[model samples]
Target: MTSLGVIFQPWSPPERLRETAVAAERAGLDELWVWEDCFKESGVTSLVVALTTTERLRVGVGILPMPLRNVAVLAMEAAMIQRLFAGRARFGVGHGVLDWMGQVGARVASPLTLMREYVPALRRLLSGEEVTAAGRYVNLDRVKLDWPPAVPVPVLAAAEGPKTTALVGEVADGLVLTGGWSADMVRDSVTRARAARSAAGVEGAFEVAVFLMTDFGEGAAERMEAEFDRWEFTGERRYAALGSVEEVTATVREVFDAGATSVLLQSRTDSDDIEGFVANAGRVRELLLR
Candidate 1:
């Protein structure tokens, strides 16, 4: 069975997350995701709040920018969260928006190189192994998490191109695809990643978590179209699921059919009714289960 989730966009105030998480759990959604956006919310803090307030809702940080935090610090933070919540926490790391990274003086010339160094070190730390590495971007000296999670934590990484996608398959436990692109494109990415995994002789379940742009209710179409225009999206294939519960559900189903282990519903960032959107996603999940 696929895991269904909703993103509590960083655009929403931090104070609203507690109620939002409660709503997601109460409505029976499987996971709730948060992401770090530059000059915005802290993904780790948001994940903690959401996890603390709910008994069963799994919280994911779809990405923490690798440029902003040291590999050792991230390993410590992730280990603490995993030990506290056990299997309820999911983490993904990425290049972050380069412009945002530059604004904060954390930009790297080659993000691909950063991933090459960062992910392997992080996985070893999370697995309670001592690591020492000196690389272009990440440098550590026998660093290890003293309190790593007793159970293994799956570390996911975000990717857009073939090189990064293949790198993720070779080193990371899962792949996180950002919003946009059709279901067919999503399938291709997963296939490419898995092929890389096989070539690397990596074995285990490799997860694919996709973010699907979604909108529902009264101005769903207009909201979706407006967001698409802002992104300068040009495509005949629907980029977002829009309209009623049933309609939105069918559109999301296409992504599942294409091979996503997890699908995170990402509503428009400027949306006014986040809680309502979570509830609607719950209804969609019910239909999906049948």
Candidate 2:
């Protein structure tokens, strides 16, 4: 069965995080993804809160930027969350978008190199293995986690382009396909990433989690169009904005058929209408699951 999840954009007040998590759980979402995009509160912090509040749903940070923090800090944080959530925490890390990173005066150049070196070091540290490496971007000496996670922490690499996707397949456990991508776009990306994995004989399931937008109401078409317009203005990819419940179902099925082990919908709403979002998601879920 293809697992379906939802992305929680913590753009509202802190109180909204708990409320959204409760609502999403009731709505039958398998996972909840929180993101950090140069925002006020970090995604990991919000994820910790959500994990504390929720009972069964898996909580993940859609991505924490590699350039913004040290690898040691990341490893420590991941371990803490895994232990705190009783092993229900998953961490996704990536070289964030240039525009957003620039806001903090951070440069995210040569992401492939950064991720390639950063991931292994973080993994070794998290697993309590001695880390001794002198690489171009990262250099560590005899560092290991004092307290390792009891359960395996699945680290997903957020990749969009071919180079990054292949790198992710070669290293990380899964791939976090950037939201706003079309089904065809996801298919192409998965094909490339899988080929890389196959060549290396890495046999395991690679997650293809996508972020999407949904709206359910009589004026769904208009709402979807407005959502597309918002993406257009922000220069976000407009492929995930489907016009109707049927369109949303089709798009999701297309990705699933293309080898997405799971799909994560990042519902975008124009109003403070939680009921409307849940209703629209329910309709789309009914059509897709049926």
TM-score versus the correct structure, for each prediction: 0.97, 0.90
Identify the leading candidate in terms of TM-score: 1
Worst 10 residues of 1 by lDDT: 229-238
lDDT of 2 by residue, 1-290 (tens): 77776767756667788887787777776777888878666977888888888899888887889888788888888988888788877788999877777888766567789999998788777877888889777887877788888877877889978999998888888888866777777788888988998998888767777766655446765666677787663443666645566776787788788778777776664556664565556566677777
lDDT by residue for model 1 over 125-187, one digit each (tens)?
999999999899988888977798878989999998899999999999999998886898898
Give model 2's TM-score versus the native structure.
0.90
- Candidate 2 residue runs with Cα over 4 Å from true position: 233-237, 241-247, 286-290
**Candidate 1 error regions (>4 Å):** 236-238
**Residue pairs in candidate 1 whose N, alpha carbon or C atoms collide under 3 angstroms:** none
